[model samples]
Target: VAAGPAPPGTAPGGRRPWRQLALLSGLISMDSSESSVISVLFPALRAALGLPLSALGTLVAVGKLAGMVTGPLWVMLAQRVSRKTVLVISSGLWGVWSIAAGLSQNYVQLLILSTIAAAGFAGGGALVNGILADLFDDAHRGRAAGYLYAGVAVLLAVVGPLLGLLSEVHNGWRYGFFLSGAVTVAFGLLVAAFFRDPGVGAAENPGVGAAENPGVGAAEPHRGGPARPGATVLNRAVLRELMSSRTFRLILVQRFANTQLAMVSFGVVYLVDVFHFDNATASLVSAPAAICFLIGTALGGQIVDRVQRRLPDAGRLLTWQLATLGWGVAALLATQVTWPSIGIYVVLFCVLGVLQGFNPGCNRPILMAVTRPETRSAAFAVMLSAESAGWAASTLAIGYAGSAFGLRTAVLWLVVVLNLANALFMTLIHRPLRREALALRAATADTHPRTSGAENR
Candidate 1:
């Protein structure tokens, strides 16, 4: 078929958000699968190296700590440099480091190599998230984000077991890393060749080009476009603007508390150590639960979008946030019990997986709603840094606690308490999110009067 005319306002060669969503999804999948696949190799690693449980925890903690510093650094650099260039460089470098991690002869070598890889990997989250916001307008961002994150969950589900099978072979885990790294390096080249910038503020309001191109025949330039040059990386003005937003502050706190559920880091370990399942068996069972989670993500995204259309003023998104927490609570209860059959354990985990997946479809869209397009990347970077810190601390704590007590007790206590705290923190965002969302929409309409017609209403 002959190509259709480029969509209005899209750059000559730029791909539409939906079209690019799949490519970005592939990037996200490759970025995360390495970590997921590695988690499954923990048992083989321990057996081969004669390492302890604490070593695994230390690796996870140190890697996350590396991400905490590098996440924001990548965002700042992207603002000064460009998104596509930064992404390509970071992806290529990390791919090399990940392959090196597999060749480590000792625990110390592996830890150091993995942390260096993680610092490079940190660019993916904030940079990709910001690009996503520019691709889809406000109305479709919820579903768009859903499709992207569902890819991550699905990729992890597949690679987790494949790596487990590999771990059964002598020195097979090293080969798995080699394959993953090779795939990532190839993908990075593709991103550099094909991925478009989408330009900041490209999709703030549908049917409006003013946000992307200001000062066209107008008395004054529109304020809705991206930040101008000469603004320093993480300038004080941007920091103050972000800090002043109540919604931003509340979301940051919620993100920190929620990281306690970084259970995937130790989930396979949990099954192997406590439930007495082999690595392959645990991964096989977890795969179906991941599918259940993907289903929940699809349903959650559609339901929340419909609710937002119906009750934009009320805390509809917040209601879904609470619903997610309710699912977590149920999953926690299920895990706490000893079932007569392993099938029941699988069923409970599926429930937990589904519940866990519900939040991602809504969370990033919430952040986009409150912040300007220019600042969205920084916003994500800030949130990620805080989240990484939380994860690092929790991983260290759980590792030590599991050694002193047991994995079951440590996971149970931390998951239950932190989640309850997260639920309470979410309540504070209900009003602030509602208020900020209105302000953003109104500002977009005012800046782009062409879209202020009934099409926007």
Candidate 2:
């Protein structure tokens, strides 16, 4: 687990990082397939196990709860070992738990096994986002993140219906876990074999005189290097460092309030229960919606990059706020209104998907702009843990509320109202975000004066 130099051909700003990004996206997509199956195949699972609607919330909640603990633990482990090793074990080798979950004969067994699998999967987000920041500079991080997430959406779009079709077969829901686990294992091996660690802060200090490396000049000493044993441990100091940032604090609040993820997690169930669509027919909406999400990430990334360049102080935050507001509007229309056809629902969900895409494109880069490379993984770990906590709360609330007041009423209140509130709340971040970003830039310039001119350009 000793830290090593960057892999051959992985110099800062190299053209070769896209392959690494693709592999990271694939790992995430496969890791996520388990949840997709649960959401899509919940009806079959319920019928087979004789469970209640609230059980869906339990199933989803357990995984998120596990993430809240394991995400930060995994990041700490990566700091001690190497991100590559931690990723291989957490994302790749962890598939065995998924396979075990698939083989469960009852609800309790499935819940236990899925929780174990989720703990390992939780490790990837912090590590992946950390590596992504090191792979690309500020100027291109948006497009890179956009393409990364769009790749995930494309895979989900292709896989969603196929998972839906599994419902047609007896005991087919188990196969979804089996397939997801197998693919996850395969990709894990692929990552171990191919993914190169882009060394912390590599993007900030491109090699001197490398004409091919864009937006950077003269190399400085690498500030972020191999961690000494326990050096990167998540201590009170690390927590204090993260909490001290006004922008980071505001982002955490926004994460808690933004519960739109619960909407998609329950979309299939909503269609099945309220609209009375069968699993197969209901799952069809996942594809077009995913495609639109893909479009949003790809297109939104480019727009965010340009907008940030034009309005460096508030552009990305503004885009994120508007997107959140638009999502609330779409959620109200999609859930509260009685649309005539599934196609109409699909159209509305597509709008929601696109707006959702704008978020990661902006928020992630915002994080990168403010945090130090050495702390980025820890920063993302904390943010994702907050997100998981929010999702767990929102999904559980949705489940109980859906049972009492009908899903239509539950979703309209939880998804629409909270999203609008989150949008308004985002105004608090504009000044802090600008302030922190400038501070980070000034610090980086002081640390690597040779590259400051190129970074500013």
Candidate 3:
């Protein structure tokens, strides 16, 4: 398919966003499958390996920490090489190792393999967003990102219930991880063999031997002055650019808060412990939350493009997240009720889904706005690194808090605090978002135009 790089002020429903969404969808299946498959198997793992809850908590913490450790290396590399290369190699390794994790016999082996697999998690988030940044001009970034997250939502929807049902069958847990790994590997191969760098004009790649076609447009200009693939994280200027942006800070800070709350959703054991459900039952029950999340994401993705047309500010997006956070907190509070019915539990699961849905849809717009095209990947790395730090900190703090104060009580407090913090950070970021977006718009207007036929109403 020929890519139509419409000049600025082009009509909606073009080809780039669709292609990019396809790319993101394929890549995100790796992540969603990894999480869902394991979430379903956590019970079987306990019996097979004699792993306890605290040990399980430690594994989750370590996986996230691996992302923190490896994110910047990928970012710096993206500046030097194609972000496309970084994503494929890293995520490919993630998929290969994730399968190995399923076959591990001992607890320590699982830990090691999981840590390696998680390393893929860090780099791709920023790199994929960077690819989308390059594909769509700023005017349609919200729509572009919305479409990307919608893909992720779709994958999550499939992974959740599919894995849950599979694990529920006897010995199905053993096969679930293996099949999930095969699926992820297939997706990776598709990306490696068929996926071109989204930022590059199709004319340059000519995957079917068309690069020789003189008609293809000249390779688009590269980001960050064409650093080699081994670029170091010593760019003081990039650091300054990252730190100076108030919006970037909020995105990072709220990532921390949101991740902290997300840590609770990982508590599938709570279903077993409090609700008196078995492992398979708990896993199946939690699938509804994932479904709700995907549904909400689809709705959000469809609307974001329209919203950007009219209310192009970050506040409108934040308002949606704040409401979601509030809903999740209310759901957690409901769990505290004595003799709660299954209906209320289902509603709370939906609440978790709602918050997950709102986050990726709303959050990416704020992230894309603050940084310009030149160093968007590195800028994302900086924010993601900060988020990782805050996430590591909060996970430790909250994990201990849950242990001491009781999981239910600790979570209730955390939901209130983190959402409050998320609200404050969003409010604090207004000037930066507006200012930087205007600057990005001005800079690109000559080349790309400044409208996406947005339909805010």
What Cα-based lDDT does every candidate model obtain?
Answer: 0.71, 0.83, 0.59
- Model 2 quality (TM-score): 0.92
Residue by residue across 372-399, what tens digits does model 3's lDDT show? Answer: 5556667667766676666556555555
Order the numbered candidates by lDDT, best leading.
Answer: 2, 1, 3
TM accuracy, model 3: 0.82
Over 4 Å off in model 1, which ranges? 1-14, 205-232, 314-316, 452-457
- Cα error, residue 188 of model 2, in Å, equals 0.5
Q: Lowest lDDT 10-mer window, candidate 1? A: 213-222
RMSD of 2: 4.9
lDDT, candidate 2, 1-457, per-residue tens: 3223336555463437889899999998777888888888998899999988888888888899898899999888776666778888998889888888889999999999998998999998888888788787788888889988887798789888998999998989999889889989999999887776656676776542122323121121222432212224566898899899999999998997778889868989889998899999999889999999999999999999999889988889999899999999998888878878889999998999999999879999999888887788889999999998898889989898988888888888888898899899999999989888998899989976755654555
Clashes of 1: 0
* Tens digits of per-residue lDDT for model 1, 1-457: 2233347645322345565676777776787766765677888888888988887778888888899899888878776666766787776546888899889898888888888888888888887887788777666666777777787778767776678798789998788778778777887888776665656665653322233432211112224443333212566788789889998988787777774356767877777888787877776656777777777677777776667667766434665577657766865765466666667767877777777776766788888888887788888888888788787788778888989999788888766667776777677788888888788877867875543332132
Evaluation by lDDT, superior candidate among 1 and 2: 2
| True-vs-predicted CA distance for residue 313, candidate 3, Å | 3.6
